[model samples]
Target: MTQSIFDKFQYYANLREDVARLDTNPFNVVVEQVLSETEAIVNGRRTILAGTNNYLGLTFDPRCIAAGRKALEEEGTGTTGSRMANGTYAGHLALERELADFFGLPSSIVFSTGYIANLGILSTIPGPSDVVLLDADSHASIYDGCRLGSAEVIRFRHNDPGDLDKRLKRLGTKAESALIVVEGIYSMIGDQAPLQEIVEVKRRHGAYLLVDEAHSLGVLGEHGRGLVEQAGVQEDVDFIVGTFSKSLGAIGGFCVSKWKELENVRYAMRPYIFTASSSPSIIASTRVALHILREQGAELRKRLWDNAHRLYLGLRELDFKLGPESSPVVAITLGESKEQALEIWHDLLDKGVYVNLVMPPASPGAGCLLRCSLSSAHSAVQIDAIIDAFRSLRNNILES
Candidate 1:
């Protein structure tokens, strides 16, 4: 029998079969309505939203909504073209300038997404001879960026500065040509990188460092500049990549750097050049969000961290195994089997709470995890409800 192109999808079919057997599909939950940044209607019930990446709870900010609405009325919907053509608008240029100013970087390049920011910069900066040392537990976009680049790729131990130093030393004179990539806060585990140590290592080897603050911006630092500023190593980082989706409450990505060569990336980077520019509404809303991130970010951060600590302590009291600490992302170890994790996840949803269900390969350490992200908008009542809900479901989850 001749094989069809769709034959390769057997793996997906098998996974679906397992899901059907469990009578619980974590990936198939539907959101019927979004009541606020922290509440939603799901499965015909009002559900507390903790699965989303709405860190600052700016999704429902009146200023952002007003900006977007104004942009829609004045600037129309989309640009209808790429930045290289008719897509480049005054608003885009203005937003880029605001971002550059916010980071105190000499140059900034805006992309269609945080993912594309990595892809564009990674593929364009290093040529065929250069090398990239990436953390083994990096995000998918970071890995994809390395694959797209022409450089030789090497994986190092996650958050281990000594291992990175050794890898660079092994490269001899080529160490200076290497790009050491790390994230401000790893997405899956909700843990942070050892930035100060990594910075020292990079300085010792005379190598450049790129920090992805995708999950850290507006969630860290004094005024929400991310881990770079939090660690007092902002001056040491070469390229800083971040997404507006997480904290800025919009859809876009940007790379900021002191090196003036960054602006030239738009010419050679395929992802930046080929894709249509962000919509005017997005640009407008993002601009407002960025302002909020700067002006009133500290208050929001305090509230978010307070909520995080409350939940972290609450879960610990229940004897649940948790991740590193009280981070914006709190992941509970749900055991090692996919079935066990899925069953618990379905139970949580049935209890009127929603969270992310992580499994092996995609999740670090190949463990099943129930991940929740804390938002500034989460109420004290909601936090208590989440904790109580988890406590009540303990027996059911363990099947005890």
Candidate 2:
């Protein structure tokens, strides 16, 4: 008798039981559960969304909606082929040009997704000979890119410039050819990378820096360029990668650079070359979204930050442990236990508030988190309601 390949996935299947016990299913959001106009009728109750990553609240925006509808009517739903084949549309070229102009860069390359954008650029450029130094807590896409590249993947402590310097010192002369990767704002903890210090270290080591601004784009910097510009280090970075998913409220990713040769990568990058390009509708909506983001981002940012600060203060007053204390994404830390976190999550859900319940491996320090994402669309009244819910839940837990 021989074991089958199917046996390997049994571990993952079994892990669902553990997740079930915690009432925390990272991959199990119900259909229309977090939508603006839909109901998550669990036992006949509706819930307000606090977990969704729709940061700018543009998913339901009339402008984006109208543009998408117009494009779909004019260009159909999909391109039906890879960009290397018949997939390239006029919309694609226009979007790329628009993105390049937005960044004030000479060239830009667009990918089917922000994940694929990172995957395409990082994997295609670095070879086995080149070393890829990444933050310990980089997104799975960044890690996957390095794995695909066959580059020596070296990780430093998250956002620790000194640890990065030490790692570069270990690499010695090889550091010059190394590609250092860091996120502008980490998705989980929502803390920003120390760009100035890291850039100074990279300059000393002569390393090329790639900043993934997936969560920072349309959220940071003047005109929402990203944290690189926010930190006043745009000229120091070699590549800037971002996604249109979050703040831009569209699907697709892009890499922008002043380097003329970046355009040549389109020929060799598998993720970009093999994958089908974005649809006309996505491209058009993103272009409009980018325009709006550039002109109106500061006002949105102000609203979002005010919401974040209020929520942060509210949670703190309730004595809930928070990660990073100040960030757009506020995560209520659940310490080292899962049971308590699950109880709080279930209680909050029952109270009509939906939030992300993150557990180990996905969370830093093997922790559990009730992650809340804020948006400009969230009203002060809604914020107060969220706070009141937490307060009530805290009291109930203490009494229990």
Candidate 3:
């Protein structure tokens, strides 16, 4: 055989073998049909959707769908170019203005996706002389952003504001040049950052602070502005990055900042300069969803929380491991062994419940997670059904 460049695929093949020869590939759960925001068809079975991040459940809202249809009929399809090219349409600008107004920030820039927003900002802002102090459990997009930038990256203990403070102190003179980045609500374990303490620490170090509210937006604060507002530290945060995919029920991302200079990021960031802009339908749907997210968000948030509490308490009562006090994302930790975790995931699927099965590289800790993200559209009966399904699999999970 000729020396092959495809030799690297062997590692993936062996890793597949590690998961008990892949009789049930959790990664291959194909959605045959989407019934609603909280239900889908998989494997010819109508499965309860407990894994999606549709917190506000606006995906199938009549108004949002109407707006999307209007845009599709009127604008055809994509913008077909980058923001720097022929892509900055009027709707894009309008959405940016609306987002800045909602957050009460001075400036905002929309990106092709939530991931791109992080990549563009991180790669462009910090250079060789700068530093990024991040949480150990920061999202992959955040980590990839650091890799793209010229900054010196440092991670402290997860959820430890004290450790972050110590790391900043060790930076000494470089502390002033450091950018402290954290998420409002960590997606992996559904835990929150001690933002108040972290903000105080950054203020003491004379460093900048950026908060990614991807999971917290439309799920926290009185009006759902996110955890930065919930903690009453909006003034202390220099920048915020969030997604339209989660709560807004559309696909796009944005970065709003108190500093108006963020507008200049477009000129320097390659991701924004090179990628195609979001379509008219996406932008149109997102704008209407944003409005609904503002007006009806309180009621939706109430429903979401109620469902989350029910599922969390139900699982806990069943003597299963759970994430630290739930909000919307309820992560049930499985065993340290990958085989056991896979078994639990497959069992739940067989019971007509669909949840996110997270393992190494994606999960926060060494253990795997059966992460359930509740939605506002999940009815009380649906919640009961999900709980019952999990209860039915208790024997398998506990025994495994």
Clashing pairs in 1: none
Write down the TM-score for model 2: 0.94
Candidate 1 on 174-220: residue-level lDDT in tens? 99989999999899878999999999999999988999999999999
Structure candidate 3, residue pairs in collision? none
Residue-level lDDT of model 2, residues 1-400, one tens digit each, is: 8999889889767767656864436457564444462124543467777776667778777888899999999999999889899999988888889888988998898889999999998898878889999999999999999888878989999999999999999998999999999999888878899999999999999999999999888778877888998999988988999998988888999999978889888889988888778988998899888878877888988887898899899988888778665777888777666667667778887787777887788887777778888887788888888888889888544433
Off by over 4 Å in 3: 1-3, 18-24
State the lDDT at 257 in candidate 2: 91
State each model's C-alpha RMSD to the native: 1.4, 2.4, 1.5
What is the model-wide C-alpha lDDT for candidate 1?
0.89
TM-score (all chains, Cα) for each model: 0.97, 0.94, 0.97
Q: What does the lDDT come to for candidate 2?
A: 0.84
Residue range 299-363, candidate 3, lDDT tens digits: 99999999889888988899887877877999888777777787778777777899999988799
lDDT of 3 at 305: 93
